[model samples]
Target: MYYVNQNQINKRLEFLNWLVETIPESLENKPESDKAILFLAQERILHLALESVTDIGSYIIDGFLMRDASSYEDIIEILHGEKVFPSHLLETLLGLVKMRKKLVQEYFHLDRNEIYPLLHELPTTLSEFSNSISNYLKHELNT
Candidate 1:
């Protein structure tokens, strides 16, 4: 059997993550809607992670911690491939963020310039998120 090293795996994960973050975010206003779309995209990435890697490090797959290759792969395929998130999850996330924005706004607040950091970091953050999932997949798959 062939074995993969962690460094090579890390590099691949990094590349995959970079690919994810570069996806366009051209939808209008609706911060919550944007966040919802981003979240769904992240979820889709996670599905790939599970399918692509072994995930021995207890990576959370759809809220459940997955330990084995089979469970991870199953969850990943179910989630990542072929339009998994559908419309419902997007609706739910958008609704929650929209309805609760007042409450969320009260506790977690950001100023105009302060928010800039997140905006500037958006690409990198999404990239890191993808990398994390890719790493999880690589570790689990041991390929």
Candidate 2:
């Protein structure tokens, strides 16, 4: 039998939702116009969102699935290995892991252009993540 820490997962979901709301829908004209503040804000928010993603993955795998994941990318792999995340999301999640690394390891000379696509997809990506987790939990609980 499998179970989840629903409360913990909900908190992560709430934080992810907040990040999605904070990020801009489009950065076409905004990044340049605002320059310093907006760019830094966008970068930080995107970094936080990626953090939230990994945290959520870790929460699920460790707390609920009772599995140990070695690294940020391994979190997603562990979830996938347990059939929590669908096949389609694997690629994007890996990309997110790399982005998280960029934000953390590559501290200096950050580029907004590279992070833009992830920000743009934050809303939908998070929605999919939330739904997938919810659906999995629901199935596990019911069975």
Q: lDDT per residue, candidate 2, 66-133, as tens digits?
A: 57888888888888888886888788777777787678778587777887777776677777887888
Tens digits of per-residue lDDT for model 1 on 1-143?
Answer: 32335455465556555544543442224477577565444434433333323231223342233223354334334433322233333332222223222323442342223232333433444454454455545555654
Clashing pairs in 2: none
Worst 10 residues of 2 by lDDT: 24-33
Local distance difference test, candidate 2: 0.76
Model 2 segments beyond 4 Å from truth?
A: 1-3, 25-28, 31-33
User: Model 1: how far is 22 from its true place, Å?
Assistant: 8.1
Q: Compare the candidates by TM-score and give the number of the best one.
A: 2
Error of 1 at 63 (Å): 6.8
**Model 1 TM-score (2 dp):** 0.30
